[model samples]
Target: MSATDKKQKQAVIAGAGPAGLTGAYELLKHTDIHPVVFEESGEIGGISRTVRYHGNRMDIGGHRFFSKSQRVTDWWDEIMPLQGAPSLDDKLLHTTDKTFAANGPDPEQCDRVMLVRNRISRIFYLHKFFDYPISLKWQTFANMGLVRTIEAGCGYLWSVFFKKPETSLENFYINRFGKPLYRMFFEDYTEKVWGVHPSKLGADWGAQRVKGLSIFAILKDMLKKSFSKKENIKEVETSLIEQFVYPKLGPGQLWETVADEVRQRGGEVITETPVKEIHVENNRVTSVTVENAQGERREVPCDYLLSSLPLKDLVQSIRGIEVPDEVKRIAGDLPYRDFITVGLLMKRLTIDNQTRIKTFANRIPDTWIYIQERDVRIGRLQVFNNWSPYLVKNYENTVWIGLEYFCTEGDAFWQMDDRAFIDMAVGELAKIGIIDPADVLDSVRIKVKKAYPSYFGSYYELDRVKEFLNGIENLWCIGRNGQHRYNNMDHSMMTAMVAVDHIAAGNTDKSAVWSVNTEEEYHESK
Candidate 1:
């Protein structure tokens, strides 16, 4: 077959991120639609790539997804499988920080699940979820008699009764979590993560994420635990909380596997090939033009195309794709706060136990201690050793302590030299007594320019943009950047699957792809 014939037969994929790679893997396995993945970065994993830092392994912003789908879990096993994964029990010891003892579960690790008591043994708590699943028992118990709990209750009542019509996150959170929790637990870490006030974020995202758990739920959990009432079947947070999984190495392993499988299935995954222009013809996506590292350009075409590139980008290069200038203006207008992860490879197996911080510290989110009080750039402290011990080196045990910093794309922190960033992290860790700077074996930094999609209550405009793009034929987009959605890894990969199924079935549907972060069974537009 000629080169063009071969290219045409193979489905051309844009971006080697998880979504793109997942689509390529399933498509190749289920159909003859050989998929060729094109990634802008030289590396395979997108936001989830694993970095070997100072002889230690680390991930970005502790980006592993613990609460997720069985389908995604099964697919991961098919590719990278958790060969060296430590048992769930072993994982517990790692996550227990002093903050956990002083406060509660970190929002990052709060994948609430039922506590299966070991009748097989002496009924020692199988997993460390307080009151198991909802954690209502633990949350209320920890904050008992504290004014903050009453304030949070008032926040909820204020939200429910006053019913703030405001849609921005700042208003939503203030209404629900009260100013104390919002300022203490959310403010600085949020400002560092998103470079915006929690108040400025859209409430819709908050609604979708932490909507189910309420003061009422907490009270119920407390009563149940007190009476030792046996629930026939423990109903965990069915809305979003449940048992979750992660890659043994790190979340990055999943995307890396998909990229590997794409090539193994006779398709191609070309990394570092940035698409300069997405060529279009007669309202259909004809091909994508890419540039190699040497500043050379090449064009590849396909009858079908799946894009995980940003929507504003796709619409800008294509004609007859009626993305209104106003709409495009709004879409382009969407902004994101960049994130930098300062991964510290310390000599110890865990952080110091003397910290008075709580797991989800009111001010610092005791889970990831937010050093907001200090003028330092370190935003949140992630005890990576708590996430998984396998990422560390040596049988003696190691600690992967991370600090999350926020910045604009080209700002000081984002542009800060790697060595300097590492130094800054070690300094901050020492100041907080979380780590001994001398004990820091080494550190590394990974900067994510588009780590989060900032919601400015302009989601209506984004929705309009989606509606416009949905009208097009034979072209699809999915993923965090792909859909401009604030999605965790699981939701993003699921978007890729929906897009793939659409093209494979020769049908047209777009809703299913964006229908994630909600407990809904989505289907391709037919």
Candidate 2:
């Protein structure tokens, strides 16, 4: 790489997300190429951003900083060092909420960078809590009586003896967890979340989501844990990890620090800039046109482009790029799941005749609970206070909880008023016996469009679109939506890492980025 090459090299990245920001930071570290990041929203993190209201902060979707890949872990540590990470006992565990914030009066005591926390979660179905990994506890057996347990065991044996062809999501779960457990735990909840029956939805989602875990494997692991007192036992599954690392303020703190570091290293991070058009010549992306907050558009020339935008939006923006008709069709047809998080503030939550006693801002032990009951449309709920003490305005009396609903952009839930949505969340919470209506204080609603790149009808057509994009050597799709992948935080960052490596090594192998998280044994979190 000569001076001429360095002078001409400028990588313009679309979307200042984990992937895009990671690519920019890596480019600055490894090469002399000037990288510029453009974010469509006022915030930095995509779905990972922490929404702050008053003095409280909430993770858009609860994120745990645990990755199987060491490279991803190292990358996270580089931005937010966990060497001297804070522990529960380090500095006053049961302290009041008056002691924390990003910019508090006493900054030293309220450092908002690195912290490790415990994780406990379960499925709430039929007003009963079941261990996520389906442990063989006596309480579990009692909840699901002896007869039901025998039925489930028999179903498992039958499935093993006569394996059915796995075609739809229903068959996929049945093959792994058996029919009885699948119907009891997965079937209806999945249908409610995706707005489609398991028999109608594609099995690809199940394949990617629960790749390595099976009923037998979970039982074996639980038995081993229950019997052994060994400290050396490692959690091979992310979902089963007892603890994880996190930013004190929330996940967004890590990315915000990354953005600042990128700027310090002579890189530009422009927020409120939406990509309007991508200009291509001779099958190579030459420039990108983006509109700023005031609706003023400008073109930025590029030697290479890394996009973290949704695949559909990315293709539609390629008007001047002359994309192949087949690729365009596939991109247009790609489906996505939008999300809404209703952040509710409450005085206290009492369940089962016991007030939720607080310890370090946690009212309950579980960080989040999967709502598997058929009655509520809310798929999951997050105990924001458990995630981080800094997330709540007051830890003693006030707590924040996030009721998450998965829906399409134009759907009824999405279009519902904030007041109605809050009321609905309260109604569901009351219906499930999780919280009391009178404890509610105030609420905030955050809607995210295309939050999940859905694995649904015609999702397989994305393979053709990916193939077409790979042919455009200068353009690389390198994130969750960028590749239409349901990648975890680490996997998303890994795609960007691989993409930047390709440019650094002077290779044209875009497949290296596309091949991420495609393994049958690869589950994003689990």
Candidate 3:
């Protein structure tokens, strides 16, 4: 067909998260297809969105922009170029890093720039800091004490000789890190995050989340760092990466920028509008019914549908289709873990700055600290000032931090009022000796629904739901909740990219989209 005679195609995308926005951007860039993205919430990025309170910004869950995929990194560069000049923190500290792009925009003068940041995350157990992934250092052994260290060494050797079958997450950790280390480090934390024992969870979570991380991997990384220069260490595992890039403001800044570019390029991004019903005909999606915040609903006709909605909701939203009893039952029984981040603006923290890394006010240099204290219900803590000096309004005078808690929706923790929850969070921090409740100047609580897709419940039977969803010719599922998989930010974007590649090539098979993060060796190398 001639260019003028060709029929224009429209793609309806649900959710304006990394997956949906990526699908829309790729469609507009690669083809003549018109894309319309609908977001259920008022914000652009889902869990990746930055919440603004007063003059400070909060990254819902801390996102470290480090990816092994060149395609993903290149795409980030296209949206927000890396900083050539020093950022606020770098300029103040008079630091120089090799990751900075030459002849790019300056973060101090320009807002659309990515800053290279040091990654330092440690575990706080028994009122001390231990390297995350359990580094083999003398201080670690000292902190662990003589008896526990001996037990850990013997348990690791035993694990190396006798491997347990990978049937559950508990077994997965025991096989990799040994029983003692797993019990000491992974046991309580995993339970806190998922609200269930590791034995009840599937082993696939370990394979995907912490693929190549183990005692041996940590040892190899230590040896590599000792033998090679910092910048030349390319084979380090993802969990052990020391440096990553981040937006000047936060992760939401990047997504909001992408949303703007989509609009400038003849695409539509409607926020606070959710797809209520998806209409299918002849085994293909034909239209979707969307309802806006004003309670008005309208049908949007489309040639294809790219969905990043929760799989349970997606399966329930289908119309003019006969979902099997098994599929319906499994979808309804799917479980999710909700998250709450309490952003506390404090005058100062009680924790001392013992790390060699210098900060503006000699504060803790950790971007986030994993709380291993069994006494407190708080799971993790994020120091926003360390994430980016630009994130905090008063980086020099005050401290900005986030306390993360994982709980199921409608539970006691989730049902608490904002003020009460914030108070409880502050008290927990004080109890953990990380902060003083009196130092908290202001606080805000942000809750995210379906923040984590659980590996338990009907997750083992997810393949049956996928089989049914894949049967629909014009529907594509992408992103964490959409596929009911706990995918990282890059993996979610890659899923959308793979789906777009298939659509652009006129391929109907959806196998590649579902296989984004499935390979064990690929993740290890990446």
Candidate 4:
């Protein structure tokens, strides 16, 4: 289809997130659609926003800009240049006295994103740092000890020779790493993240995330790294990626820029507008009723509608249509994992060695440390300064860390008052030997609902829901929660790209958009 021919249709997008924004950008650039985007939150990025708190900016959860898709990488580079810029000598730079000034350097004005080379992330369990993805190293041996290491090796060999059928998340992990390794490295952390036992969770989530990786592959890759000269092997799985790009301020900068470019191209981007009612007629979405922050309702009519709202919410909110009772029940039952990020600002501190006390300058260099310790409720800890110099208000001796807690909305932890929650988080940090409670200068807590789509027992019902939604000719669901498919940031954007292509070509192929990350092989070469 010609670009000019695509100009006649008006596209209305729900949620100005990565997928919705990418869809709008694609439509505005290739076609003259001039799409209108509506974001329910006050910010542009949905869960991906870089929230500001007391002169500091931090992501809700660490969002690394790594993807195995070249198209997605190119799109990111087009939006925010990740190269051809002078590097900032972060080591030489010191925190200035004006760090806490109200008027700080604005990331939007600079329009910059730092392409961080490679950062270390280790599992902190049993007072030992184990390399993530289970690398063959002395520290791993020292942590597991000789007997446990031998047991792990035998377990892997047994699983390789006698494989079991995969049925649940437990089976998925055990099928790859054997029951021993799965119980040691995955059991507690996985349960903490999902709030469900692995045996009850569906295997689809595991396949989408950690598939194409096994004990054999890890051993083979380790041997090759020690002996071979060839590099950049294509078979390496996504979980084993060592390096990734990140925005200077945070991921919000990228989506915020996309919103600005869309406006510059004569497109409308509205925030704090949530679609409350979807009107369907003749098996097509005709219009939607939205409510603003001021409690004003307005009807937005459009020829084509792209939505990034949760599939359950979208299915339940449609009016003037008769959705199947079974579909509604299944969709509504789809679980979600909420998130809370507690940013703790601490004064200059030091950890004492046996001989003498030393500064925390380079003591812990991990961007984020996975909490494999089961006692604490905190699942992970992100060192904000480690992610980027711009993230922390002061880069010198001061420190900023984000404690991530995974919970369901309205649960005991989620419903805890901010002050109480802050206290609990600080106490936990002290308990975990991360920091002293007295050293904390200030704290801020941010709660995000439906941050992760949980793959529960009802996840298989999503196929039926997708089949039903596919019958609607004018509506397309795209994004992580939009499709309930635990897609990475790149996979989410790729879905929008394909959705735009389908809309422009006047083709009805929801399957094409849905099939993006379902394949077993890497879609892009290094």
Tens-place lDDT digits, model 3, residues 191-265: 999999999999999989898989999988888778877654346678888888999889999999999999999
> Model 2: which residue pairs collide?
none
User: Which portions of model 1 show Cα errors greater than 4 Å?
Assistant: 1-8, 80-161, 220-235, 238-243, 319-323, 349-351, 354-377, 395-397, 457-459, 518-526
Candidate 4 per-residue lDDT over residues 337-440, each given as its tens digit: 99999999887434322212222343466677888887888888887766776777756657888999999998999889999999999988788777899899
Task: Give the alpha carbon lDDT tens digit for every residue of 413-500 in model 1.
Answer: 7777899778877776566555677777766677776777776645568878887777767678788888887776767778888777
Which candidate would rank higher by lDDT, 1 or 3? 3
Alpha carbon lDDT of each predicted model: 0.61, 0.80, 0.89, 0.80
Report the number of clashing residue pairs per model. 16, 0, 0, 0
Residue-level lDDT of model 2, residues 1-526, one tens digit each, is: 8766645589999998889998999999998889999999999988888888877888997898877677777777878777384453333335554444222333225554577776777788768888786766787778788888998888988888787787888988888878998888888888767788898877777777776668777776777677875623245554566667888778888898899999999999999998889888888889999999998998999999999999888888885566788887888988888899999898877653122434544456667889988878989989886787667766556778999999999989989998988899899999989889998988889999888887776587778888777877889898888988878888888888899899999998887798888764342331
Worst 10 residues of 2 by lDDT: 99-108
Model 1 lDDT, residue 458, Cα: 57
Model 3 TM: 0.96
Segments in model 3 whose C-alpha atoms lie over 4 Å from true places = 1-3, 93-109, 230-234, 521-526
lDDT for 398 in candidate 2 is 73
Q: How well does candidate 2 match the true structure, expressed as C-alpha RMSD? A: 3.0
Candidate 2's clash total is: 0
Which has the higher lDDT value, candidate number 2 or candidate number 3? 3
Q: Evaluated with lDDT, which candidate comes out highest? A: 3
Query: Which regions of candidate 4 are displaced past 4 Å?
Result: 1-7, 89-111, 227-233, 348-360, 522-526
